[model samples]
Target chain A: MATTVESPGIRREWQRFTPRQRLIRYAFYLVAVAALIQSINSVDIIPEFLEDAPAQIVDLFARMWPVDWAYYPKTVHAALIETLHIATLGTVLALIMAVPVALMVATNITRWPALRLLGKFILVSSRSVNSLVWALLFVAVFGPGGLAGTLAIAFRSVGFVGKLLAEALEEAHKGPVEALTATGAPWLSLMLKAYWPQVQPSFWSIALFRWDINIRESAVLGLVGAGGIGMALDDALNLLYWDQVALTLLTIFSVVIAAEIIVTYIRSKII
Target chain B: MSTAASQPVAATRQNPFPVNWGARLGWVALVAYSFYAASLFELTWERFVVGLDNGAKFIGRMLPPLLGKWDLLSKGLLESLEISIIATVIGVAVAMPIGLLAARNLMPAWVTWPTRGLIAMCRSFHPVIVAILFVKAVGFGALAGIMALIVASIGFIAKLFAEAIEEISLKQVEAVRATGAGFGNVLIMAVQPQVLARFIGFSTYQLDSNLRNSTMVGIVGGGGIGSTLFTAFQRFDYDFVLTILICIISMIMIGEIVSGWVRKAFQ
Candidate 1:
């Protein structure tokens, strides 16, 4: 029944479907494509309206090439270092804050409905707001620098690390925890002896992963004056220094790629 | 010799997370760097006190968020919606084919390598950076934001799609081929069914992401609520900034809820 080859001479495989099924499929695709086209048209990005777009883009790139390689020693190097510092410090701060929050949010650990709800709320609200907005807020308050950037990254990461680690804590095997409780281990001791071991891999993975992301984030936080390589890039663009912009971008690209490679290597070795 | 061998086993039982030299040294260096950077940034208690005073004033002004700028707010919101929807739709459509082409299980190295490289380039920069590039390319407005997000969407969804396709069981594909089915028949009968659910899940998630990203792109003159929000901040219009923040947060939370429902319905 599965192999329904009709003729030996034919190379084509035809599906025998009812007319209604074919009609429905066609109508479904037609509707989907039509809606998509409508939205595209609504955005009004048609090339016809911007006849010189290609030329402008070509000119922009032509201007950007032959990057100001000399810009590195003056500013790019210091900016790159600050960006890495922001990511590293932020990740550590987030991890310190997230541990207790993760425990409170995990259903198996917290047990109290109200506490869990509060923890979940913190996680959701933190994750919901983009880091740029957080950076903006901190910039307004702190008047812009690497401190604001670090705090923004930390706040943004708390939710991510907490949420994932909470899931990890909840999924841990119950047998060890129960055994520790039966033996009258203190709450701290029980967690240390039982939960910590099981959730260690997940906790570290989330921490490292967030650090990698923070690297990318802190790179651009300077656009809002949070202080990083992004500030340099933003300034260069503002001044219409396309060559400097090109150099800044290239530096950012290499830094991000290097971070990726480092994280991958560490993860492989550890995980 | 036997006692020495047993000594290491006893030590293993004492720690839940054993500290290797690499991790131990990593920790020491991280702590050292933290203090170094803190000093470099000149973090002082006196400075913090001044910052706190400013923060209090900012918060005081932010209360009772003003909603008087309905004209600008609604216009920006509508444009952001259009940008996200159009970007998501177009990005997902383009991604589907590219994703399939990039599937290592289905494609030759020559095809997968270049397609994967393109996706990587798309993802390397944050959306705001890409938006800046596109704004410079296409000129400022929703059009540039939409274009940047399409590239962002393609980068994200295509990679996940390719991974999903790679993970599917190939037995069904083999069986279809054994029946002398054409390549299209095999794909339709075997490959499509396996990956369709996951594809939908990725698409919904991408839309949710695009919506949040659309707001921020406007800050770089890429057209969205972000531009208004940026202006409000620059002018120190704390109440308006508060209102914009509330609107953005609510939209994101609603997106989260909607995507959750989408996943449930599809599952």
Candidate 2:
């Protein structure tokens, strides 16, 4: 259906492939696949319990079939709210903090190469570390709460927003900046009047996009006790409350979808 | 204020509705809710101070990260790298057909709907959540982590792949079709060349991301360095945890560099 062809002539033509062509195509795939299958069989990668995985998954789904709706109001609601809060607050804070870093990293803005390198290093390091790991570190530092989760989300977002923002900054129309600078505009005024204006639309979109991503990241931060629906999820999982777990997962899915819709709508409006 | 002398600059739009009211409302609501949320979370200055003290101590302990657990470290790293490579290969391979089917421009609604839905479901949950589910299903190990990452890899790349296919110039596909070529031949002759570079880029990026997530899945007992790091944390082996973190970060950075190189090389 992907192709426009409507007739069965394609299959008949497929069979007409020369033997040599077929052999060459099949041989490589066959060898690679055989090696993959053989390695799986040879390695201890598969555990004994894996044989029962299907059955266990079936059982697990059965247990989770009827989500505990009652759990939402009492347990999940607040944590879900906390997760949303973490995402929003984190994205906002990250955007604000990223402004300076973005400027420093943008070659057109920063004068010193060393400062640019420092900015790039900060972005790379932040981007490289997973939010969960940051949450783990923050949990140890802040004793596990929304603060830790919020901070984790913020720090993780810094690299992402900063990198994109810096690129946007560098790519901003130099025409305006050069025009303004020639008029003897100070650095701050020139940036505010020239650079900021150019990147505003993109910055808005990136901020929204980052918020959408942060929602996904913060949803899982609770697993490490950084506080959110995820911590509740961790608790439910630990207690084997499969019904509650199902409910939590559903909440997360809905929130993600909602955020996605929002981002789509905003980007459409802007662009 | 300074723009007053600029004689109504082009940046100053004449329309009263130039401001995006919806966005303004969004910002206001976000700020208001942040304050309310802060209160609910009890994010206090006093608590922050105490936390900072504890964090300082934690940092102090992490200064000289322990590198003594070479066996555990290398084993987990090797497993993670293996998991990443295998997952990327399998995920990209499987995603190709699904992506083709999911491209709304190429396929009928019925076909695209189910395929797109599948991609969405794959993407709905975070990798860690998926890892948790797989760990339970597969009874904990690198296999579970591998399976989770595969699903993640598929989810991450398939949507992009579908978009790439959708964006392909049908002019080329039509020209191939005009030659009375079979569908497969048309795909190879036209569609493949345009999309292959992008597919490679997405695949490499997925691999880089998978490497990071692979180290993380073990936190929930799915298997890898995360498990070791989690245990060190639980046992209050801050030094060891720090060491694992450094390793993980370095590995991720290396993957980032490699993937960047791959993308640049192709470009």
Candidate 3:
């Protein structure tokens, strides 16, 4: 505790945190540390591998030093293009699918509580499972192609886009909606005229953001034969073609950077 | 009625809905590209119908999901939980210093630049890709999954931490410094108080994300329920796959609820 003297006879004391809060904080820290210790104990780490990790990393890097640039024109290029297409198409598809879901989820838009719960459940299911897992499911049904990759990306993004879009719709200005209602506007017209404009900026922003994520995701979908650069990377990895692996990794990196820049630029311009 | 009134009405009747050529062109380009991409992928109506039919059968097979492989499923699930916990702990510990160094407000430009670049590189790849690399380096196990998730946690939480630090009120920092306090003391007294809540929030969020990712790293043999799920998929064990998926989703949902409670408590 720190104390300040107001007078010689009367001193005031100050404390940073209340005793209860301090206790809570300490308990949280204790739990975290205990969890960490328990997990570390349970996760088996072979000591020899741990000891040689540095050497192994160095050896791996050495093998990847001279990347096979020749692999690009042969296979990597087509895969990269397919990845971009999947991301773009998937984003568009997700936006289309998410609009109805968003409407259902937005409490102000959808009056039914059960529907809202159902919409939330749909969103959660979409989001909880990783896109890779969705890709696995779609790949099974669609038989391992760009279509499966696209569907996975679309399904995953439906949750993200729908959640944000619903929030935006919920926060729409009430005045316009009231005015629309006074004029006896139909539900469709009310949604279009009042809610659409209010959420347009955020909708585009969400779309672009999800599109950027989809690019990175689609790039890796090929690992499960869902079609994209990931398939090429998977092939190289399996063959232990370090140079090709390095090249594929570099391509994925550059593409990710490019997508980020493009999304940022578009978002600034649009929103 | 009057000629002057009629003239004013005619002048006021200008077009209210002006077309934006730029937006129209963008939409056009998007639609065109979508068409081209669909054709490229042979995504015709027939293909979609066929997919739907296949999906119907798939769902039918997945119904009443099998939970008979409790031993295997539990093992994988436990391994994923352990991986996420260890990764989050190590990653957050490692990220703190990196985040401090990367904060432009707190560090020199030289220190911030390379550190920011490293964060960007860490963020560039998906965690699975990183897991693949780690699997190659570490000879495939929970170690590789843990390392992959550690990288992801650092990339995510460190960037947000650095940003949060940058947004701190410098006035508090200056006042602390004016008291002749050392750098460490100033950070503890001024910076930590401002960012601790947010740091905790980011950490919990990262833990949730790491948990989600840990389940998937096993796809690349880094170790988790994902390898088992993948194997199940290959064997056409659709019911088992559904069981695994339900378990994963429920686990994540529970994690989300717990993290939400933690965040509220801290706040």
On a 0 to 100 scale, what is the lDDT of residue A90 in model 3? Answer: 94
Worst 10 residues of 3 chain A by lDDT: A1-10
Worst 10 residues of 2 chain B by lDDT: B10-19
- Runs of candidate 3 exceeding 4 Å displacement: A1-16, B1-11
lDDT per residue as tens, model 1, A239-264: 99999999999898888888888889
lDDT of 1: 0.87
Chain A TM-score values, per prediction: 0.86, 0.85, 0.94
- lDDT by residue for model 3 over B128-239, one digit each (tens)? 9999999878877899999999998888888998999999999999999999999999999999999999999999999999999999999998898989999999999999
**lDDT by candidate, in order shown:** 0.87, 0.86, 0.92
In terms of lDDT, which candidate is strongest?
3
DockQ of 2: 0.39
Best by TM-score: 3
Model 2 per-residue lDDT at A18: 71
